[model samples]
Structures are given as structure tokens and as C-alpha cells.
Target: MDVNTRHVLIAGGGYVGMYAAFRLQKSLRKEIRRGEVTITVVEPRSYMTYQPFLPEAAAGNLEPRHVVVPLRRVLPDVQVITGRVVGIDHAEHTARIDPRDGAAYDVHYDELVVALGSVARTLPIPGLAERAIGFKQVEEAIQLRNHVLDRLDVAESTTNEETRRRALSFVFVGGGYAGVEALAELEDMARYACRYYRNFRAEDMRWVLVEAAGRILPEVGEDMGRYTVERLRKRHIDVKLNTMLESCVDGHVELSDGTRLDSDTIVWTAGVKANPVLAESDLPRDDKGRLPTEPDLRVVGAEHVWAAGDCAAVPDLTGPPNAVCSPSAQHAVRQAKVLGDNVARALKGRLLQNYEHKHVGSVASLGLHKGVAQVYGIKLRGWPAWFMHRTYHVSRMPTLNRKVRIVADWTLGLFFPREIVSLGSLQRPREEFERSALPRQFSPPASRSPELESAHAGGRPEQDGK
Candidate 1:
């Protein structure tokens, strides 16, 4: 079977896959026009979400729609199928795709790109599965915002102090970028929301961060991490270092430090592991289950298969001596650009470029008006760091249109207040009204007017002896 005769199938549609497909579409425009090569992308979602701004999206800084790039619109030349790639039969040069609606498929791919990304790493701790929310997707961010506000609403109206305390207490497990940023943003938002609540006060709410390690933000160095801890503590946030979550059952959280707390919300952003799909493939994976890749971003042994991003253990040539690339948006995005370009080059029989990027210092959001940053070994704290955090991420947010939208959101946020309105009705669609009306219809006949019945039933009424 001639390899170039078949299509190139990319899996995941995340940072690497989407960008790779875009570069391929651009590089192979003439080939695609002449029907020489075809590109097919298999992903569970139709859109590729930029994850860095998810914290702000959760805090209502950026609109939800502006954070993601539609795969179909970005790569129209490529066949975008909403499906899960089950496995890679590298020996047969085929992939098994499981479509949500219909039968599974065996797609023959002359070239394959494994960019399935990563999943939130979790432990076998009791009740964590039920009690914790992850910080991965846009939906999770939005859901978190809604859940927090709902908890505030409960606390404001409840008379029981215990229940109110539990409603207002939020425990976050993990001290990484996600946990820190989310806690900071939510704390800011909650503090702002307190002005609107008659009974609920910002001091009444508790924000706690639990980390197993001695320090947080490993990327930001030990000194900066300590600075962050101090800043958070100044705001009265309980930053419990060297602590672990033993269990969280029935809203009661047990910590390794022999402390217990009953909280309604628990967010888990401790770590991430390579997608479970990697186990189904024949590619060479490291002990941690990430696909082993060369510096050039090609799979270790396979000729046609390439990988990058969090799912692949990329060699960090620019690391302190030697280390693997940290699973971060910076590495992922830069690696994706390289991976895309390499794929385009490989297709055109050109030399591929090696992936070697120096580590830029880290920036973290402390809250609304505070932050910490370390760039080129110069540490910055307070509003300067906070502004830098937002500025850098917004600049990297993909596409000029989205950049403009995000800037507009930030500009409006300065003058206008945060939109804390909870449209919980949005979650139920039209079913809430239908539910209330349906129960009323089951009441006495006189209670149900003819107009109401006609309106709800589309101009029809229940059959009866008139």
C-alpha cells in the first residue's frame, strides 16, 4: 500500500492536533487542491479551547465563547469528525475511531499524529471522585462560577450557621497554577459579590489551599512560591503547605494534618497524566505513560507518527542540565507550533526542526489587585505582576478577533461591575417553566385556563368529555 495515497489522520484536536492541521492545510493547499493528500481530524469536541484564560472565564473576565477556536472554521480543508480515537494499529497503519452517533470506523492513515493531550491526575482517596471538580475545560470553569455563586446564595438566606459556613467555605486541593489562579479569582469575585448580599460578608467565607508539597508553583521557583504563599496569607486565605487531602465525604474534608472542615466546594488541580488513550497504542511510552518523543517531536520508533504537548514526554534541551518539559500551556503551545511545522516539512520531504525552548519566568494571579511574577530572575509583586499576568495571557490568546474581544471584556470590567447575575434557568433550558406549569395542570381543572393549556400544549388540550 502506497503511504501517500491515503489520508493523514490527527487525533485529539487539542493544542498540537488543531495547530498541526492548520499548518498542514496551509502547506498542502496545492496538494489538497490537486487531491494528492487528505487530512482528517478525530476529536471528541468540535472546538479547541485555549486553557490559560479559563480562570478569568470562570471569574467572568472573558466571555466563554471567545476562549475557544472552532476546529471546523479554522481548518475547513480538513475533515473534522467528532469522535474518539480508540487505538492506533501502527502495524496496520490504521486508527479505530468511535463515533458518538453511529458505528466505529477503521481509518487508514498514511501518516498519524498522536496529540490526545492529558487528563487530570487523581489519587484513590475516598470521596474525591464525588466531591472534587477539575480545572481543565471551559464547562468546568463556568460550572465552578455558577456553583460558587449558588453557594453564596444559600449562605445569604440560611439561618443555620453550620450550613452557612459550609456553603461559604471553599477548599481547593493543589497549589499549581490552576489552583492558585482559581482561588485568587474566586476570592476576588466573592469579595466583590459580598457588597450585593445583605447578610453574607466576605470575611464569613473561607478560602483554603492544601498542597502535599512543601512549596507551590514549582515552575516559579521556591522563592517566588514562598512570596505567593505570603501574599495569599496576607489576604487571610488558609495556605496549608505540606498537607494532603485524606478524604472528603458528605462535605467533610479530612486533611493529613489532622484537621477537618466541612465545605461545599472542592477543586482538584494537583496534576495531570497523559490521556488513557496512550495505553491503547503501540507507541513507546515512558514510565509515567507519556509517549516518548525525539527532540524533533517524532514518535521514538514510528516513522509516520508524531507527537507533542502534555501527552508526549518532550526532551527539554534547554532545561537546567537535563529535564523533561513541564506540562504547561507555554510548552504545549510552542511545541504545537513546532510540531505543526515539522509535520508540514515531513510531508514536503524537508528537514524537521528540533524543539528546544528556554524557560521563561512564571506569573500568577494573586487576586483582583495583586499578583507575583518572576521574569529573567527579577521578582515582581503586587499590581504590576497582576497586570503582567493578564497582559501576557491575553496576548497569547490566539487570533486577533479573540484578542480584541478579551481586551474589550477587560476594558469594560474596569468601568462596569462584575456580572454576578445567576441565570440558573440557562442550565434547565425551558424545562423549569414547563415543570412548574405541568404540576399546576395536574391540579383542579378550573386552575388550568384554556389559554394556558393551548399555549403549553401547542394549541391542544387533554381529551375530556365536554
Candidate 2:
């Protein structure tokens, strides 16, 4: 609260927030030592997830812990607060925060950095929220792995043909990199897992990918996308293009093309929208509900306020006029550094630079050894593309510790097969213990609810009472 000291409060601990804090701390190390400036980062999570490695983690290619960088460890000089920013009054230069375990409080800041990233852009489809899983966080990726492996276990143990069929059927919506990589990696894992089951064969399992768009992996160009579709089809995986998921009620998937299938697993990775926290603040936002920023990442029409990452609509100076940077890690990482340097420059009363980066390319991993990439206009596929995908992500992943761990996982994977163990109970660790503690007579009735009954019976509820 000293008059000479400046408090810089960052609203998120995502890619942009973390990197900006890192840059600011490094750039203003002298000021920080002199007690002239302080940096505080407020976010819900203690760690920043490297989302590109999520699919591989889910498929047991990398450990879950290695995919996340602890903010405190990474930003030792900066104050890391595990909390959510509920409201921000830029006019007053005050931010209201709700700490994870404490009461809400307001903190005044000389400068504000809005870097709260995006959230899953979901729809109002019946049973979608309850049944379908997303592929965003480390937890979701881990849960999907367990759920998929558990489904295979259920199919192997069950004699009912319909039940087995449903358990073996996996449906993924969306054709973006997230959806494609997740589906491909998981399918590969499941296929390898079949070797352990005497009754289950890779052929018996169904992998269905439904995309509302005309093609999948649009970032890799039309030819590569078409090739991806062909490769998937060759593996007997159902690739439905120009298709929409009508409903997923009770795991009964209905497509726009009038096809119905029973699937136990539904992974949704359609799209993402800017974090809704922007609306709570008095910041100027664009039509897409994103904070509008100048070429230099400073908030348009606001003083001492800057924005970047998926939450900010940063103009793409390297692209055509009126164009904006795409919401990808490539842009986010670059934008963060520029945004940080600009903040430091503003503090020192120096000139600011604009954020301008040309579109490099995109890479998508399909299964273990299959991938597609279009880097700097050069196209690649198969093993070369897959190697590029891993190398690119590992290099970008924060910290050398995490990089080494992930590389170690891959190295070990080469010697041993992918582990297909299902640890679904980790999602609800206390469930069995709580149930066991209950007296036999006082136990909940088996017929009380279909969901409870299914849990007790270790089977899914029958459709229409079968």
C-alpha cells in the first residue's frame, strides 16, 4: 500500500497470466528488489495445465502430474493467490476476490491484467452435461481414460450382447484438434487394451467421430483433413462429417442424419468461449464477449488495463486488416511475452510494441504414430508429423522438469505397453467407504433410484426397463 510501490494484479494464472508475471518479474527485478513494484496473480487453480498434452495423458502416454506446471513453483517471485476474481472495478482500481478457503476481499491495483482464458462452449442438448465428458483439464482427461478402460472391463464381464455393444461404442463430437487427438489416442489405447481381454477384440469396439463441420482438422488444410478421414475409415472407425448430435439422452446418441447408437462414452470438444469473468468487470469488451485490445495488447479505451490470451480479442497485425489472432497456444504464448514487456514498458514510461505474429502452422496427433502438420506451409504426415507434434509441445511446455518427466514417460512407454488400468473410483474416492460405513438395515433401498441401483449392481440402467 506504499505510495511508491505499484501493485500489479493479474486476473488469471493461465498461459498469458503466468508468462506475463514471469516477464514482468524478470524485467522489473530491480524495482521488485527496491520495493517499487509488486506482482500478484489470482486464479482458481494452483497449476497451469499444458492442454496440448491432455490426449496423450488420457491414453497413458504421459503422467497427469507432468502435464501441469505449479504456478507457485514457476513464479516464485510473484504472489500466487489461489482464488477467483469475482468482480473488478477498473474505475476504482479495485478487484474483489473470493479465495478458495477464505472470505472475499478487495485488493487495489495500479495496473490490471485480464488474462482469464476460455471455457468449454457447450450446448443445450439433453443429457449432454450429465453424460458427456469434456477434454480440457487434467482431471477430465484422466477421468476419460478411466471411463474408457472401465467400459472395456464392463463389456468383457457382461454376457448381454446389447450391453456389451453399448459399452464398446465410443462417440466423440467435434472435429477440432482437441476432439481428433483425444479420440485417436483413446482409440489406440483401447485397441491395445483389447489384447488382455479374451472376449473383446479391437474389431468389436466401435469408434465414432461426429463433426458438424464439412471436414476435420481444418488447420491442416483440406488435403490433410481428407487424408485423416480416409485413414480413420480404413481402421473401420466411423467418420461422420456434416453431422450434428441431435441428442445424447441416457447415452442413446441420435445424430442429425437419423442414425441412433447406444454409447456409454461421449466426449465433447466442440469449441470454447472467453471466460465469463470479463462480463463481471467494467472492462470494454467486443461482441464476442472478449476484452478488445490494441495491437500492443493494451485494453482499448481503458488506462492501466491490458488483456491477452483467449480472453482478449488481439488484432492480428501479421494477418489481413481487421483480422484477429486465433485462440491457440501458439498465439497465446507469443502474446503473453509481448503483453508482459508492454506492461513493463508502461511502468517505466517507455514506448510499447505491438503484438504481431504470423500464423506458423498446426499439428494434430492421431494415435501413437500417426499425425498431421502444416508448419510454415510445409505439410507432413504419419511418423514425422507425430514426432513434430511431441517435440513442439514438449518444448513449449513450461519448465524443464515437466519436459524431462514427459520425455521419460515416452521413453518408458517404448519399452512397456500402455497401461489400461481403470481407476474410475478415484473420481469419488469416499463413495465405497461411505457406503460400507452404513448399517445393513439402514442402507439405501436398491430400488430407490435407477442411478443408485446401477451403481450398486455394477451395470448400467436398462433402457425402457428392457
Index of the highest-lDDT prediction: 2
Mind giving the per-residue lDDT tens digits that candidate 1 earns over 1-466? Answer: 3454547889989888888888888888888878888999999999989887888888888898889988998898999999999988899988999997999989888888888999999999899999999999988898899899989999989899999999999999999999999999888888899999998789999999999999998777888899889888988899999999999988799999998989999999998899998899887889999988899999998889998888998999987654888888888888988887888788789999999998788898877768888888988889998899888888777678888998898899899999996655566688967877774534537788886878777776656785
What are the lDDT scores of the predictions, listed in order?
0.88, 0.93
Candidate 2: Cα lDDT at 165: 99
Assess every candidate by TM-score: 0.92, 0.93
Q: What tens-digit string does per-residue lDDT give for candidate 2 at 370-448?
A: 9999999999999999999999999999889999999999999999977889999999999999999987865676559
User: Per-residue error at 283 for model 2, in Å?
Assistant: 1.1
Task: Report lDDT (Cα) of residue 174, candidate 1.
Answer: 95
State how far residue 159 of model 1 sits from its true place (Å).
1.7
- 361: Cα error in model 1, Å: 1.6
Q: Which runs in model 2 stand beyond 4 Å of their true positions?
A: 441-466
